[model samples]
Target: MTYTARSIVWIVIYLLFILLPLFALLAGSLPPARDFWTEFSAALGYSGLAIMGLQFGLTARFRYVTEPWGEDVIYHFHRRISLFAVA
Candidate 1:
């Protein structure tokens, strides 16, 4: 695929990785329903963990993965997302 296509594919994969855990959690048996903020907070916590975990892959410098976006852009995204995940 072209660079743009590869980049889009990677973006989709990243989103799926982050969301898969939330989906799995919802799919399984759960406790009684809670307030909206409580559920929202839980979802945010899961997403943050996923983002933080993916940082390792980002910094691994896989040529095919980084080629589409360039190492600089990838690192920039990594830094920004790290901050976001922390927040």
Candidate 2:
């Protein structure tokens, strides 16, 4: 595949991997929270946790994933994104 096509494919896969847990939550039985804040907080917590976990893989120097963006760019993002999780 050409460079553009390969990049697109990796982007899609990355998106899918990061969002897969959220998509599963939609299918599974949700928590019994009637108030919007409670549900919203739960969703936010889940999303943050998912992305935080995936950062490890992104920084692990995987050739296939890092190839699309370059290793330095991938590690740079991992550092920045991890800070949000810390806060």
Candidate 3:
């Protein structure tokens, strides 16, 4: 695939990776629904954790993964996303 196509595919994969936990939570049995803020907070926490976990892959420098974006772009994303995850 071309670089743009590959990048788009990777973007989709990244989104799926980050949302996997949220999908699992919805799929599994759970307690009664809580207030808006409580559920929102929980979702945010899960997203943050997923982003933090993805940091490792970002830094691993896998050529197939980095070829589309390049090392600099990947590291830049890693740094920015790390800050976002922390917040």
Most TM-score-accurate candidate = 3
Show pairs that collide, candidate 2.
Answer: none
- TM-score: which is higher, 1 or 3? 3
lDDT of 2 by residue, 1-87 (tens): 878999899778867876777788889986675898877777778878877888888888889888877988888888888988667
- Which tens-of-lDDT digit does each residue in 1-87 have in candidate 3? 888899999999999999999999899888586898998899999989999999999899899889998999999999999999997
Find the 10 residues in a row with the least total lDDT in model 1: 24-33
Total backbone collisions for each predicted model: 0, 0, 0
Instruction: Write down the TM-score of every candidate.
Output: 0.94, 0.80, 0.95
In order, the Cα lDDT scores of the candidates are 0.92, 0.81, 0.93
Q: Rank the candidates by lDDT, best first.
A: 3, 1, 2
For residues 1-87, write the lDDT of model 1, one tens digit per residue. 887789889999999999998998989897577998998999999999999999999999999778998999999999999999998
By TM-score, the better pick of 2 and 3 is 3
TM-score of 1: 0.94
